[model samples]
Target: MMRRRTTLLASCTALALALGATACGGGGPVTAGGGDKALSGQTVTVAGVWSGSEQKNFQKVLEAFSEKTGAKTQFVSTGDNVSTVVGSKIEGGNAPDVVMVPQVGVLKQFAEKGWLKPLSKTTRQSVDANYANVWKTYGSVDGTLYGLYFKAAHKSTVWYSPDALAQAGVKPPTTYDQMLKAGHTVSDSGLAAFSVAGQDGWTLTDWFENIYLSQAGPEKYDALAAHRLKWTDVSVVRALTTLGKLFKDGQLIAGGQKEALNTDFPGSVEKVFGPEPEAGMVYEGDFVAGVAKDQFGRTIGQDANFFPFPAVDGGEAPVVSGGDAAVVLKDGKNQKAATRLLEYLATPEAAAVWAEAGGFLSPNKNLDLASYGDDVTRATAKSLVDAGDSVRFDMSDQAPAAFGGTKGAGEWKLLQDFLRDPSDPKATAAGLEAAAAKAYRG
Candidate 1:
C-alpha cells in the first residue's frame, strides 16, 4: 500500500504567493530568527554524508542560521557510512549535536536505540505547516517525530542533450519499448544511446527501483522494499529482466558495459553533456542538471533537459525519490542550540538558501518556486512536491545498511555483478534474495 493524502500543491501555491510578496520587499537573505541573534555563544555540530559542492552549499544554509541567531555551526562529513560513523561517535561520547541521516532505516535505528531526541513541538509544527504528511511520516519512527527532511531527489528523470537528440531525429520516449527502439536508432548513427554509471552500484539500484515501481506497482514495491516479499519473487525477476534489456545491449550503452562499469556518476553525466559527447542520454536524478552545468559548463534548459523516465510495459510511470533528514542527538550537550538549528531547517527560509544555489530540492511546501535557480529545477521540484505521498522512496534506503548501503557487499555488489554480466536475471534475483535475507535477519 501507499500513503495517501490530499494533494499539497494548492496550499503550497498559496503559501508561495504570500512568501513571494514579502521576499520582494527586502532583497536580503531570509533567516528563521528574523536576525534576533538570540543564540550567540552557542555552538552546534552536525555530521552528514555530503562532501565537495554539496557540503559547500549546506554550509551556506548554516551561515544563514548563524547570521539569524548568532550560533556557531560545525559540519563533519560522514562519507557514505552514516550509521557507522554516527554510532562510533555516540560510543565515544563525542556525538555531534545533530546529524543529517541519509536513509530512513538508519534514522529508525537511531530512534529505536534512544539515541535520537524527539523534535520540539515548535519544530514539529513548522514541519506540519510546510511539508506533506508523508515526509513527516518518513522522519518519524513508531509514530514519534524525530527528524525533519530538508533535501529531496527526483529519481525518475532521464537527462539528454537537445542537440544530440535532434541530430538523432528522435523525441523522448513515453514507453519502455519506445525508449529501446529510440536507443537503437541513435546507435545506428554511430553514437551510444545511453551513458550508464555502472561503477557506482547505487546508480544500478535506482535503475532497478524505477523499473520495479512502475512494472510491479506500489504494493509489490513496498513489499520488496520491506523484505516481506523475497527478492527472488517473480516481480523482482521481471524488473531485473527488463533492466537487462538495456544493460545487456552493448550497442545501446556507451563504450559498452566495460566502459560503463568504469565510469563514475559524474563521468557518466559528462559523457553525454560534455563538448565531445560520448553518448546521447543519461539516466539519473535531477542532480544531473547541476553536474552538467557546474562541471561541464552546460546550460540547464538549453543544453540540458530531461524527461520523466518512460513507463515500463505500458504501465503508469512512477515517481521514485530519496531525501536526507536532519535529526538531533539526545545525548548532545548543546540540545537547545541544536534544536534551534533544526527549527530553522524546517522553515522555507533555510530551504531557499540551497535552492538558489542550484542542485538542491526542498520538500518544504512553503518554499517559493521562484527560489529555484532555473526553470528545469523549478519544474522538477514542483513534480516532487505534487507527487506528495504517492512517491515511493528509494528502495535501498528503506532496507538495512548492511544490505542496501554498503559498497562491496549486499545489493550494491550484487547489482554491480549483474551489470557486469546481465544474461541471467534469475541468477541475479537469487543473489539479491540471499543477501537481503541475511541483512534483514541480522
Candidate 2:
C-alpha cells in the first residue's frame, strides 16, 4: 500500500517548537522526589500515528506502565501521516518522551543524525538474548544502540487461492523452475499465472529484491545496498536476466504493469480470490490479508494459502520481513524510562498484545502462535518462526534512507522492461548499475 510511517524525532520536534520551550513538560523525567526511587509520577507524552485498533493495543500497555510506575501517559495521536507529523515536531523540538515508528531505516536515519538516544548496555543485552540477530543489527547503528525492533511482516511469500489452484489443476511451485512451469500451466488453463503490480514501483521492486536474495544470497544483497558492491556484478546481471525472462515468457499476467498502475490494492487483492479473477497468485506482505477479507469476501485460512518466496538452485534460502522501530528523541526527558518502555515492548507479552491488535509478526522470540485467535494469523506467524534463516526487513528498509525508494524505483522499472525481453541482459544490468552508482554517490 506504500504506507510509510514517521520518525520519533519528526513527531516531537514540531510539537516541542509549538509548545515554545515550556520547561519541557511531560514531567521532565521521573524526579527523585522521594530521594531513592528512580521513577515518580512523571508525565510522559508519547506520539504515534496509531489509532483505532493499534491505539487500543498501545493503550493497554500504557495503562499498565502508568499504574506500576506512577507515570502519567498522554497520547498525541498524529492521524494519518506519521512521518509528516513526526518531521514537523522534530523541527519544533517538542517531541514526545517516546514515539513508535514502523520502519527500521528511519530509526537508523535519525540515529545517524544524532536525533536518537543510545540504548543502554543492559538494553542491548536484553535484545540480544530475546530477539533474532537480524533485529539486533537494526537497533544498532555504528556499533551504538539507538532503537528497538518490534513487530514484523514477512514479504517473501506468494499468496494463492488453493481452491482456485485446485480448480485449475495447478500445483504450488516449490522451486523457480517449478514456478515458471506452473505459471505456464495456469496460463494455458485460461487463468492468469501471477499478478504483479509494476506501476507502483514498490511492488515490482520487492519482486526484484526477493529474486536477488534467491539468486545471489543475503550477504551480496547487503553489499549491494551498502554500495560496497557493484551492480554489474555477474549475480546482479543474472537476477535481472531471470526477471526479464519472467516478463517476456508470459509468466506474469497480461498487462500486469498497466493493470497494476490503475488497480486499487483492495481490488487487486480481489483478483486473487474473487469470482472474477485476473490472476491466481499474488506476491505481497501479510497486510494483504485484511484487504483480502474486506474485499474478496473470502476468509484467509479457508480460501487462501501462502508459500515462501520460492528458492533457486544453490541459492541461500532466507525469509525476509519488515517492521518499524521506536526511537527516543535526544531532546526528550525520561531517557531511562523510555529505555524501559522499549525493553518492555520487546517482551513476549507485548508481542502478544501487538499480534492481537496489528496482525503482524512480533519480534519477540516467544510469540505464541497458539494465542492468535485467527487461523490465518497463526499460520502466518508460524511461517515466520519456522523460517530456516531470518531475513526480516527488505533491501529497501536496510538500505540508506536517502537512496531507498528514489533509486530503487528506477531499478524496478528497468527490471520490468528487461523482464519483457531477455535478449539483452547485459544492457539491462548496465542500466541498473549506473543508477546504483548515482544513488550511492548521492
Backbone clashes, each candidate: 0, 22
lDDT of 2 at 218: 79
Residues 190-234, model 1: lDDT tens digits: 689999998998999999999999999999999999899999899
Give lDDT tens digits, candidate 2, residues 1-442.
Answer: 1111122222223323222222222211211112222346667777776665556767766765554455667778876345567778878877777777655556666676677887655456556555667677777889877777666777877888886678778788778778878877777777778776655555666777888887888788788766688878898878877776676665467455456555544566777877787777888888677657655667877787777778876575557777767677777766666765665565454565556654467665555565565887777777776662456467766654444444235565565566445578788778877776775565
Best of the candidates, TM-score: 1
List the candidates' TM-scores in order.
0.93, 0.79
What's the CA RMSD of model 1 in angstroms? 4.3
**Candidate 2 stretches greater than 4 Å from native:** 1-85, 249-251, 333-337, 388-392, 406-428
lDDT of 2: 0.65
* RMSD vs true structure, all candidates: 4.3, 9.3
